[model samples]
Target: MSGKGVLVYGEALVDIVPATEGRRAEAVLGGSGYNTALTLARCGAKVAYNASLSRDTMGKRFRVRMAEEGIDQRFVSDCDAQTPSATVESIDHDGAASYRFRLSGTAFDVAPPEPADLSDFAHLHVTSFGATLGVSGQAALALMRRAREVGLSVSYDLNIRLPVLPPPDQARSAIEERVPFCDLVKLSYDDAVAVDTGSGQDYERWFAGGLPLVLSTSGDHGADLYLASGGMISAFVPASEVVDTIGAGDSFMGAFLASLWQNGGLGPLLRDLPEEISASAMDFACRVAAETCGERGCKPPRLKPKPPYD
Candidate 1:
């Protein structure tokens, strides 16, 4: 049977933000996978999150929030250890935020592999954190292997958090290792530059490992979609007024996937989407991301159906 939903596998943790005053900061439950899963669910996609969570209060709260957001939690597992946590300072002058993570030895650090039945999902999204964490890395790889075995489409968001990986070389290696396995790979302009250098042709070479599709987003400058089929398709959707840029990329990813699924064009769109169709899809995603930035935290407002295209 063909799968009807997307499976999102990775970490779910608390984001602790320091208050402006000397008061204690607030902790919001979030992670790259969590954010993407929530966005997908909000956009009306049937999504299931598979991740390890601690028995701590933060973890429990995360589970409750997932249910409230209509995301399936059957695949989530709870452990005795603490959930992963990251502390974010205030926004920088450029509206970018910096984070310091405390994830070592945490429950999410040792994610267990999902059951073979997980292949029932139509698509799987694995993030950089899932593939770079300790035991979680092995588990994620196992899950990816199984997904591919079942002929499920795989996508990876190169959500590179420099602080987590420490050295630049290590981060690049970790990201490059997962590219060949993904049918769809997404990266930021900053991340693309960090992984390779040169002109557009050279950038295409970096993605030449048969990834099929490469999406690179440049804040304010808009996004570019590279198809292995032929020439590049570009979208210059200007960024809306900024609030906080956190989770904007995840929102874009979720919207893109949802659009592909709804239109029954996942494979063709990834292989050879027409310029106009590709631009419209990317533009809708960009709008979703911009709306996400308008909010204080990672969770964006619910998505509504757009008017039919000409």
Candidate 2:
């Protein structure tokens, strides 16, 4: 886990955010999956991004950003379609963003990679629109199955949005079908309420069925970590100067995964980590998320370890 890498699979798109005090849309490298890769690379995790990239200007910007952030582009899939772009509007002064996607013509057509392509990684994480929408949906599910088959620690995030996906029941069913293979499942409370999350019962059933961990986050209320072995860790949140929480959840996911892998690979952490270590990891994730929220977009403070969580 320390030396191999974390392979992040899913959408890499541009988030066009309107300038808070202006009328123009400012483009940020968008998508939850992309942000997680970026943060992990910035944290010094050996990271590779796996998604289709277009040859368009926005795609070029995304490619450059990945390079600058130290993410490996070797697994990228090329597509003739335009790069995906999501339009996000700030609904409140807190910089909380509401997103609507423009994906039909974009390049999220990811296919599962050849086994050799993924052999170098120690862990894998997938999220966002790639887990839904038919275009890349089957590919995503296929990749997760293969990852689990290969015995990699697999993580999934249900960052689902109703506006871009199928009906709730259909979406929920797809996700549930993959739950057995995942070692960790992360969600925001809002994500839980969305299609495919199945409220808390889904999490309970997965846990009862032997899923390793279920983490549910609530902005500003801290987060909850439920273990399959029977216990819970309440991850306390640190305060920060409020800016806009554009990619807070992604930042949290990246940091949490990084921390978990650092102390022990997912298998070890799930079965053996002390409560203090688990709480410390969550606190570190919260700090990274808080710092991201202190800025306009998904910027995690240069990733560094803070004092351990008490």
Candidate 3:
């Protein structure tokens, strides 16, 4: 899949969210990879989504949404299996969510488009189901390996689902395999804890060795950025009118990548991007997430003009 902008590799699932307490759930087009692509395109980045899309109704809706946003769908492959979906149940007054997956293993299969198929892409963003589940996990690993060989800047999100993935010990082993392939990693505090108790020096030590950067989000507490060459940077959640937090993190990632892509640099940016440049990316990301939270569901707004740094 050749592209001018970022290519997001992962699952494109429908999010069946609760419309009213104890009432029927409304199915919405979502998934970290799809949401990231949608947000990036709306932000005016030339983006493409590479995934195995089901030919079912939900998959059709998802593809239509991508086209409507002007995101290229040439890399998407069609399948006959049922589209995977997440049945979401919100918890507490904050509207934070708990999810249960209905999986069909009907996500991306990496047989076609050989590595040479990828051309002229500025970046690759990977996350969610395709990064960890059965065939999806292998697909992600293959693409990451190819990206490495072809010299494409890469980012990953450990959007871990505890109930759906393997046991903790096994999950860590799986996660460890992909971390080294990424220049940037975005994982939530919950993911950090669920994946490896995320409080130990082990994670920092690993980052120090392989990963160039990581953004660890702590829900309402904002996020912390760890840089390989520099110390940690922090950004607090800017105050905003609260809405359900669905897709907030994905929006953060979308704006984050958008900042780096459009930043005026001809040479590779992720590996040696200046300290301030990365910090500015976080600030923009945090604002994007906050704005997404202000709206219901995962509707990421168009990227506003870049704001002055704090």
Q: Which candidate ranks first by TM-score, i.e. highest?
A: 2
Q: lDDT winner between 1 and 3, please give it.
A: 3
lDDT of 3 by residue, 1-310 (tens): 1235788887778888777755565787888888898888877677888787788888798878888899988888777877878888664577578888877545444322323466768677889757776877787888988887778888889888887888988888887788788888788988877776455475577677677777889878888888777678888657477668888889888887776666632125677767776677778788888888886668988874253343
| Candidate 2 residue lDDT tens string, 6-84 | 8887787788777655555577886888889988877667888878888888888888888888898887867678887
Q: Which residue pairs collide, candidate 3?
A: none
Name model 1 segments beyond 4 Å from true. 1-3, 21-24, 195-203, 236-240, 267-269, 272-277, 305-310
State TM-scores per candidate: 0.89, 0.92, 0.91
lDDT of 1: 0.73
* Alpha carbon lDDT at 275, candidate 1: 61
* Number of clashes found in candidate 3: 0
**Strongest candidate by lDDT:** 2
